[model samples]
Target chain A: MIRTAFFVSGRTAITAEILGHSLITQFDDVNFRRIVLPFIDTEEKALQAVAQIKAQAEADQCRPVVFSTFISENLRKLFVMDEALTLDFFETFIGPLEKELERQSSHTAGKVHAISNFEEYKHRIDAVNFATTHDDGGMAKNLQDADVILVGVSRSGKTPTCLYLALQYGIKAANYPFTPEDFADHRLPKPLHPFRNKLIGITIEPQRLSQIRQSRKPDSQYAQLSTCEQEVKLAESLMQHERIPFLNTTRLSIEELSTTIMLKAGLKRRCY
Target chain B: MIRTAFFVSGRTAITAEILGHSLITQFDDVNFRRIVLPFIDTEEKALQAVAQIKAQAEADQCRPVVFSTFISENLRKLFVMDEALTLDFFETFIGPLEKELERQSSHTAGKVHAISNFEEYKHRIDAVNFATTHDDGGMAKNLQDADVILVGVSRSGKTPTCLYLALQYGIKAANYPFTPEDFADHRLPKPLHPFRNKLIGITIEPQRLSQIRQSRKPDSQYAQLSTCEQEVKLAESLMQHERIPFLNTTRLSIEELSTTIMLKAGLKRRCY
Candidate 1:
């Protein structure tokens, strides 16, 4: 296998790896070593990255692939003489957009990953707080404030999906757990009655939920497959009885689950 | 404000909105109504999007700005005849990378945001589990497997930062709470003493901490500025005394805080 060293010029390695992965991972027989260049903020940092890249290339016997989300033209110029396969994010999108919009590009690095707009940033922070505080039916009193309240059994991917909704869309997502007693109640839970419009019931395959529970609590009654099946069936019946909008978490990823939740709830994202 | 409509062709509106937000939001005195194109999977979906765009344009009396992260060339061709300033993601980066890497682009829509790599995807799910379970020392008993542990006073942003690190980088991050009592010890908490090397202390300014606490527990003793001040000072000194790496989260965003934490700890991203 051909080993490829990867050098990224950004404050963090996230952007470079995200855009690069979908593109680069398709290449067969190539092992990628992702090295986030130390102190990549200015012209001096750019030179330091180059020096490190040069040393890595000599050791590896192959030119490193440089993926840049760097915005400044000054910073991009420093890498022009470097011998590497460069994928520049700003150079690719900015020029065309500047001409198209008839405006100047901001050329700001880490725009997507950074807090470029403090309002949107704060929205995310608030959403995080809301999701965490309202998690696992922790604060039933706070349910009415939630934009969307996710209801499901414990260990059924509720917490992660709610957190994703918070982080990605700045949606105030709260989740409530259905216990054995709550599941036995033929009627809807009393706490969830007032905000039934906000309730979106989540269910999962018994096997999957069992496996998840077993991972957390091995060989316990909670981890039993029979218990999972009974709970999931009861939850589904309750959702139908209550006429609640429901979704299956058996196959959906967290992002997909959050999107579908928003779509079903008809909730608008507070911030992008 | 002029009413301008917009269309994006992708599996999800998320990537389109995220990359488009920073660049598009800068335009002053213009209102944008972004319409995500109807399922762009076939020729019919393309025609549906065109019809919707046409109706929206007619209603708004302005030519729209179209941003396509649509991967298929066939689908892209359908938009070529449309009258709008198109911002294409594939046409920009794929050509250069194709030439440099000597591989054809996958041309798949939503590859980056979707479950392109299952291993990386599973890492995120597991990291999220690790983060939620170990949050605020809830599962301090399970700290042996954590890649890193975050310690901070209440409302100093430990939970959100840990979650961000988990979601973004797939790092197994656990956060421990430090009360005034623990901080008075002038060293790491007893439970965290074993994982001292894995510790990354987090601090926030007293004013910011007070504001955050006030929002959570309004008018409470925890929201008092003096309490915040005393707690923060002790935490910072404890970190210094133990030679533990720390960062102030008052001005830093979640992205910046996670990046700084990783850099200070010399931690590599466990997954993308």
Candidate 2:
């Protein structure tokens, strides 16, 4: 049995669990151990955890691949020095983010300005709040309360993106349907109109959208090859005309789509 | 104006934004610059970000404290080495979690399993799902679908917790109101009797309950301190006699209470 352990350290326990579960889902036929140690606030704890994993690996006679999020340098160094552990995926993944944060830090210095236009931002917040309350299927409301809102047609990875946003960010994110109704109207739904600035549209390659929809609805007009092409064209045109920023959810995980959308929308980020 | 930039690197951008917003709420007078750098998946990118922040700090003449989550170590080290930045709070918080994960890796070598027992944990998921559905003031339904049904008086944090569990862990947590009608009848609601083994009770301190109730209905009997106290006492005694596990949500955050109840009920964790 290949032994794997996910060490998630963050302010939010729920976020760690979601990420751990998703990572576990990527592997097949592997024995996985998930232990959540919350409130990891220091370097000493990181080292102690490393020592424990090293001992466990020797006892089990198996090399361990440790997947960790939010570990400190002092402890990470101890793991790196050990010859037994094979991989440190967290270090590999976070490498880019840290660098970017540093570069951006200088550019943003003295640039952080509060919304003196609190009234404007407040209006935006209220619009979103209204959109959330008015949405049907209880789904719209769920996403409207989201720190970020994703607008897209069916199967553009809205549900998954919403779930990822909620699960990973603990943000109440809502996705609204860009249905035929919205398409024919040639405008965002009336409820979404006021929050237009916060409105982000998600588009996808027509072929990809069709493929995804095919899995769910197969024979419907919504999933038909031609219909998908037309819808994509129409949605893109609408977003362009209205000047709403949109993203292609095709070939992206819910994580990727949400990150791109949030970036484009300039939504406040909760997680680092 | 003290400018603060939030560097978010995570799977969910909206979550990052919501967290950013929440953090912003913590300060009374600070300039907040919201920068959304998405799809940051490499160390070099993190370095670039660090450089950017450093420049911004020099320009602003104030060292910036970065709020980040899920950032990598190589990047974190780069930031730490850079004297331009003052704090990386997420990095500090994740330190301990890394160590704990390393320690557990040995004992549970390859034993960590991502149990697809969502079906088994369906009740908990249902309850949460129900709460989310009901939280936006939707109707309670599919009581038959609940796992361990929760019955309590209103304002018990039932809806919030249920939604949290569902949205966070995908637990199917269903909650029913122990209305005066149900109490007068001296029986569990009709649908809940069949799932008695799955029934859990929730109660709150009378004063807290009164306070919460007052928010929705000021000057109502239900919001009276005495009335709340009576209901809580009755609910507690009844649950004890019925052998149902119960929790008091008065002091617990929705997260802590949910974890405690799930553990006490032996409910399989839905997320991790």
Q: What is the interface RMSD of each candidate, in Å?
A: 3.0, 11.3
Task: List runs of model 2 lying over 4 Å from the truth.
Answer: A4-31, A35-132, A137-150, A154-176, A204-233, A250-262, A269-272, B1-38, B41-48, B59-81, B85-148, B217-222, B269-272
Clash number by candidate, in order: 0, 81
Cα lDDT tens digits for candidate 1, A1-272:
45464646556655565566655654544567777763388777788877777887788877777877676778877766456777776677667656756677555566556665657767888999889889988888978789999998888888888898888789999999988888776777788889998998889999988887887789999999999999999988888988988888776667667777877788777765
lDDT by residue for model 1 over B71-179, one digit each (tens)? 7878877776445666766666677766766667566566555554646666887899899889888978889999899988987888888998898788999999998
lDDT of 2 at A111: 15
**Tens-place lDDT digits, model 2, residues A1-272:** 45656443433344445434443444445566655544344667666766777777786676554544443444455555352443333344344434533332221111111222323322333332333343332444334354556677766656445544543444456667777777897887776765677777789898877876775577998899899998888888889888888877554544456556656755643432
Q: Which one is best on TM-score?
A: 1
Error of 2 at A30 (Å): 6.7
Winner by DockQ: 1
Score residue B173 of candidate 2 by CA lDDT.
Answer: 72
Q: Please give the lDDT score at residue A194 for candidate 1.
A: 92
